[model samples]
Each structure stands twice: as C-alpha cells, then as structure tokens.
Target: MMTVTRPLTGAVVLSCALSGIAAGAPARAADVGRSATHRVLDVQARRAGLTTAAGGYPGWAKTTAPAISVRRSAAPPRLVAGAQRGIDVSRYQGNVDWAAWAATGVTWAYTKATEGTYLRNTYFASQYSGAYKQGLIRGAYHFANPATSSATAQAEYFVANGGGWTADGKTLPGMLDVENNPYGATCYGLSKTAMVAWISAFAARYKQLTSRDVVIYTNSPWWALCTGNSTAFRLSNPLWIAAWTKTLNALPGGWPTFTYWQYTDTPIDQDYFNGSYTRLQVLARNHA
Candidate 1:
C-alpha cells in the first residue's frame, strides 16, 4: 500500500518540460493550429471569474448533444484489502435503482457530469439525486476534451452544471476523468507540455470554484504518456487509478498511494475507495 503525506492545500505546478518529449522537437502541425484556439478559450475563461456561475461563458452557454457508449468487462471484480466499496455510473447503466444499489453496501459513487465543453450526461439528474437520496455519497466528474476545447472552459462548464460542491456532507468532490480521448487522437492531439498545462488549468479553476481538490481518474500508462509522468498534482488532489488487473503493479502521478482503485468495469464499473468506510465518509464535502 502507498502512503500519502502531503496536505491538500495549494495548487501544485508541474514543470512544463516533459522528460520524454524533447524541448527542441518541432511542433506538430495539429497542435500549432489548435494552439490559437486554445489561447482564445483560455482568455475568455480568465475574463469571467472562475467562481462565477457558468452562464454566458464561451463553453458554458453552448450545448452539444453527445452520444453515449458503455463498455464493461465480463470478468469479476478484484478486491483490495481494507478498502471501502464504491461505484461509478454514467448513462450506460440507464436509470439506477439507487436503493437496491445502496443495499449492496456501496458507500459512494461518482457519476458523469459534463464532457468536453458541450455534452452533458442525459441521466445525470436521476443518477446524481438518486444516489444522494439513497444515502450514498456521490460526486460528479468531467470527461476531458483537451483537443476540442480549453480546460478552463470545460472546468467552468462542469462545475456550473453538476460538479459544484455545497459542503452538505453528502457531496463528494468533483473528479476529472482524464483517460483516453473520445475524440480523434490518443493524447487529445496535445503536446506533453500542453497536456500538463491543460490539466493544471482545470485543477486550478476547479479548486478556485469549489474550495476542494478534484480527484484525478486515469490509468498509469495514460498518465505517463500524456503528462510525462509528472507528480505535480500529488499534493493537491487524490489519485483514482484505473487498473483492472488483480495485482496493482504500478502507480503514477508522484503519489505513493492511491485513494481509489477502479479494479473492474464489469457489472457496473465497481471500485474501492482505499480507506475505512468511516474515513470515506469523512472525505465527503459536507461531512461533519
């Protein structure tokens, strides 16, 4: 088991210099073209205060219908010792029977909130409120689209809709779903430096708005490739590792331990919040 010693307080800045990506490497044509677009969005986000309600903002005011995809493994979930059970849900699960689900000893859940700058989950209302009403701690996450829009726009859009925290004890802090890019290109078509900066902008804005650190959800390989294996966020956010294997062979992002492990995607994306159940409760936004 890994141990975390850093207090979740200030934002951590990662070096712009990624190890694998040579500093002098010629810029990719795709990145060069998009850099202009990304800068505009960044500027627009700055003009609107990060904490303001996400109305009239560049991405916040826009709407784009999103297609949903659900994929789950057929294998049974692997268990981690001394971990509290949890689950993450999206439109793929359809309408959740929160009562039935909670009865299974699931203590917490994270649901899909916003994707990119436009698409919001269709079932977010039912699932988010249903989990809460069923006496389970619940949080929302944004599926990142670094290639399509700036992180600031997406971050504001996410918190404005469903990712905001209220200190109600039932609320779990927002999470950033930064894994495979659903759009074109594997690393969201971004250079490694841009990837780190995009994530930094999102995390900074999220912390500024919610007064809480966001949980990062991604696999070790993705983290290594995208962010150059930077541990910059270790001090400010919790790590949600997505490793489906029985034995966790590797962990990334500079943290010695993981807070959440998505061990399986089968039977509704089962997970373990790495701690005692009571400790999990204490991590809730409004828990007294």
Candidate 2:
C-alpha cells in the first residue's frame, strides 16, 4: 500500500520554498540589477552593524557620513545689536584681560560667588567689581547644594557671600547653579516636592532682599529629572538651560523655553571683558 505521507508538515518546507523564491525571483535582467543593489546594501549594513540604522550614522562616526543639517526656527539675535551678550566665569582660575575681553563684544559678566556654603575664589569679587567698574553689566552666582541638610542654610550662605545688587538698584537676575553636586548625589536628588519648596523659599527671600527674580540655571537632565512637573517651581521664572546642541523650545521632551543658552564653555573672544569668555546669548527679544 502506497501511503501518502502528510506533506512535510513543518516550517522547514516553507523556509525552503521562500529561499527558492528569494533566489529565483531575480531571474529577470531588471531584477538582477535590483538584487545586486540589495546584496551590496546587505553587505554594507552587515559591516556597519550596530553603527548605522535607517537614520544613518552620527557625524563623527565616519568622515563619509552625510552632513547633519539642523533646522532652526530662527537665527539668534545678535548680542551687539541688542542690550549685551556675555558669560559667567568663576573658579576656572585663569587670568583675563577685561579690556581685551570687552573688545570682543562681551556686554555683561556673571561672576561666581559661593560654591555650596563656602566662598569661591576670592579673586572673583575683585574681578567682578572691576568688570563693573570697566562698564560691563555684571551679576553674581551661587552654586546651589540642594542635598544639604538645611536648604535655609544654603540660601543664607548664598545671600551673605554673593553680596547685594549694584548701586543702580538693578542687577542681572540672581543665578542658582543647580547642576550636579555631591550633596545632591545625582541630578534627580532634589525631588519635585522638595525643589518647589526650596526654590520658592529661595526666590521669596532673594526678592525680598535684592528685589530681583531668582534665575535657575540647570541642564536638561536636571530639569527633566527634578522639575518636569507643572507644580514644580514658578514657570514664569527665567530659566537658563545648558543645552550644548539644540535650542530650547516649548515642546515637551525638549529643554524648556530658556532665556539663556549656555551653548559652549570653550573660551571665545569677547569685546567687553578682559580675557576669553564662554559665549552665552539671550534667546528671546524680551528680557522677561
């Protein structure tokens, strides 16, 4: 009795048929060209595995990679055309020629005052004061340590060491450098609840004393991990976001709309300061 075995009931038969088609489907001359293209692409992709995807490789990965074209909403306003443009400088500890720096179009400067509870380089006071004397718009900064057991103590230290606003009763906003610090341990250490209370208290006290809004300077990581919630801190407060590549936007998942972008820390020539300064420019036309 000739028994007809059930047709090889397995994926192996199906795979064989698919493989045959994959090989024979390119019989036409036109299909041959397409097959050649696919084969070349497959080989190249295998070689580039884990490096490139449909989005393509990054700029630095290979010199042959396509240039990345970024679309900016609008060109940043020139600092010279506006009020002024400058950078914050502190304990990086380098000699700066204020006149030479000023000549490079540096219109303002923010000097580091205190780090944690301790005062930073004593020279900043003199240098900061000198910049003001030389006619550069000047402000002061305090490196915040939110992880400190006492937020009030940290605030008090900043108030004491950072000094009062200038004689004009006008000062650039008080900056709180809230980036990574050992006390905080990590970017998110200052929880949203804690941050709101701490920032509110700090701002309230700062305004009562100096009558200027407290400007919060932090990177995207800190903002997302610590202050992404709507209830955290005052949204109206000017935000200085440290985003090296892209411009701050109102979109979610991006850096919040920042008043200032700390684009680069690498030294660049400025007009109003004595030496090379990190270049920071305002984002919007309105200073608010």
Candidate 3:
C-alpha cells in the first residue's frame, strides 16, 4: 500500500494565519484566537481516536455471507431539494436545536461518530439522537487515519458507534474523513492496490453488518494519494467531496459527481443552535 505522510501540526497555525483574524488585538482578538484554538483542539481530539488499531475482519477471512450490493434506485427518497443544503456537526458546536435549524433551510446533517480503532465521540449518540428527534435526516462520519495499523478496525469502530444501517435497507452511512492529519501518516500504509483491498474489506464488512453503503469523503489530493482511481472502489456508493474553493463549480474533475459538497468553513444562521451552523446539501444521485 502507498504510504502517506501526515502534515505537520504547523499547518494548523498556518490555517489561523489565513483565517484573517488579526493577531494581538483586544478581547475580540482573544475570541478569534479561541476559535482557532478550538479548531485545533477538535482536530487533535479526532486524530487521537483515529490512530488506534483494533477491529474488522482481515481480507483473507472467508466470506461468511455475500457482500451487500448498494443499488441506487430512481425513486430514492429525497432528503433535500436539488439545491440541497445541510451541515455537519460535532461536540464543538454543542447542543444543536434541530427544530430551530430545520426552519432555517438546513435540510440534513452528518454527525461525527467514531475516529479510529478505539475512540468515539462521547457526544455523537446524544447529538445524533437529537437530530433524529427533531426530524432531521442524519449521517455519520469517522475521522480516518489511514496511517494506522488497521484501517478495518477504524471502519468497524464507526459502524458500531454510528448504529448499523437503518431498517429501510438504507442508511445515512458513515463517511471516511481523509483530510490531512498532523500526527500520523496519510492513506494508511497501502499502495493503491493494497489500499483498495483494505478499504474494500472494511467497507464490505460495514455493509454486511449495516446493510448500507459506506460513503467515501475526501478532497481531491487526499483521494488521489489514497486511491488514484476514484472509480476503482465501489462505484454505487456515494461520494461526499470537500471542495472549499470560493466557487461551487471548482470541484475536482475525477470525483464522481458528488452527492454532498462541503462548501465552506463559515457557518450560517441556524435557529436551533446557539451559534452559526455549517451548511450541506444532498445530491440528487443519492436522494433516490
């Protein structure tokens, strides 16, 4: 498998510099610094959980049952309109009032669940439950550290914590968050071939247990580093691309037409939440 080196923590400092928050201001400056600090803390917390190495069946294991095939039917339930909009949430955001946000054109949400082989977000269950109670369609995400010893373990962790697929044979499946990590390696330790095998095994096991497809969430460079061929993995599973370029049209060329676009880091007004809320939209392909 190809080995991907994790970016250094200095990247976080650089991110703060680019945030346009002036340095050494008064109390307001402190707030900006606090936000930057929190952002780094969130990333560190997520990375800590994602680095564990325990779980998932090995590739050599016999296929006890057939792998579940994810089919996109023409009549899939529409979670959002063509201009679908939603947000991703975690503990950092805190106690989201889903009902309040629902009124603000926030149509869907993806919550952070597991990070790696052993750790889970303590807040995931309550937050996810809250979103559901408030009638928001929800998905879960796993902060992926492909450099860890067992990618499959990380996948299993996400599946177990996020709750297996829903009863309708469909799930707001878990996404693999493959952005740059500061402490560990990237893409795990697999070459493109091995990466494919490892991820396929992991994804297949999750599908077998949950009966839902595992979605791959990535940016262009990360995807290229891990799986050079975006189409090599399960084609039917949905793709959630993070392209924060100012224009919505700047999506990478190789990605399957994405189902969800993480357009920006800034949050929009959401009544259910105390502060700003992130926005997202479901793509038409996955709606059905």
Top candidate by TM-score: 1
Using lDDT as the measure, which candidate wins? 1
| lDDT, ranked from best to worst | 1, 3, 2
Consecutive 10-residue window with the lowest summed lDDT within model 3: 57-66
The estimated TM-scores of all candidates read: 0.71, 0.59, 0.62
Question: How far in Å is the alpha carbon of 80 misplaced in model 2?
Answer: 12
Candidate 2 lDDT over residue span 1-288, tens digit each: 111111212101100011111222213221112112122122322232212111100010111111221123244322232334566665332334566556766667777676555434455666577677767767777766565435566666677776446445224666777643322134325666677577677777776776666667654433444554333444656665544443332311232344555654433211222122222222111134
- Candidate 3 lDDT (Cα, whole model)? 0.48
lDDT of 3 at 278: 26
Regarding lDDT, does 1 or 2 come out ahead? 1
Candidate 1 lDDT tens digits, 1-288:
111122112211111111222244324222221112221222222222211112111111111111111122233233346678888876444467777667778889888887777666666898899899988989998878787778889899999889999878888889898864422344667877889899999999998998888888876555665677787987778888776656665567667667888876444567889887776777884321
Question: Which pairs of residues have clashing backbones in candidate 1?
Answer: 169-286, 169-287
RMSD of each: 16.3, 23.5, 14.4
Q: Flag the better candidate by TM-score, 1 or 3.
A: 1
Candidate 3 lDDT over 1-288, as tens digits, reads 111122222111111112221243112221222232222212322332222221110000111111221223334222233455677765444455677666766666777676556445556787688777766667777766566547667777777777455643223666666554433344454676777676677777777776666776655544454565446553556666554443333223244355666655444211111112222212211333
* lDDT (Cα) of model 2: 0.45
Ranking according to TM-score, highest score first: 1, 3, 2
